[model samples]
Target: MKKLPVNCPSCEKSLVVSQLSCSNCETVISGSYSLPILLQLSSEDQDFIFEFILSSGSLKKIAIKLGKSYPTVRNKLDDIIERISQLQKS
Candidate 1:
């Protein structure tokens, strides 16, 4: 089966699913669905998050793998943290 498009094209953001349909009965259900705040972040931020997770939250390793200075890695991490907090609140 083909997967449906699940992200915004222009911003590359994820789309929240809030509706379901019953094929046999032709019944449809809908509700409010909010996209996670993290999806509002830039693609770079998302990549940083993935890398951070893969590196097991090790700043030194992340910095080296990303070929960025330690301070840069730290700064990126800080930005990601702020985003996460905002996401949690929303």
Candidate 2:
């Protein structure tokens, strides 16, 4: 399945979840709703986070898994941390 976008492509604005449906019941609900902070991140950031979790939050393991240098992995992690912090602050 294709990933759902968390932001608008044109305006580069965050998108709201306005409607939801249950495939099993065909029940639909509509309302203005906000996404969690993590879900608001770009897809690349989300993949990095998923890998970090799969690596048990170890930079060394992440570096090895991604075949990147340790410093590079660390830097990426640092950037992700700052981005997440900024997102949460808003």
Candidate 3:
């Protein structure tokens, strides 16, 4: 499946979910819905989150898997955490 776009291509503004349809019943629903905070993150960030989960939230394991120094991985995670906090506030 194609990744969901979080921004408008032309204006670069964040995009909202405006419509959804049920595949089973063909029932359509329409409304302006804000994208979840996580979905609003870049794909790379999302992949990091998936990796973090799969590693059972172990920074050491994540660092090993990414072939990165432990401090670098920790900084990356810290940055993600800050981004999430800001997103939540907005």
- Per-prediction TM-score: 0.60, 0.90, 0.91
| Per-residue lDDT value at 87 in model 2 | 82
User: Which predicted model would earn the best TM-score?
Assistant: 3
lDDT of each: 0.80, 0.90, 0.94
Stretches > 4 Å off in candidate 2: none
Candidate 3 per-residue lDDT over residues 1-87, each given as its tens digit = 798899899999889999999999999999999999999998989999999999999999999999999999999988999999998
Give stretches of model 1 more than 4 Å off: 1-29, 87-90
The collision pairs in model 1 are none
RMSD (CA, Å), candidate 1 to true, equals 5.5
- Superposed by TM-score, candidate 2 places the C-alpha of residue 14 at a distance from the truth, in angstroms, of 0.9
- Which should have the higher lDDT, number 1 or number 2? 2
The per-prediction tally of clashing pairs is: 0, 0, 0
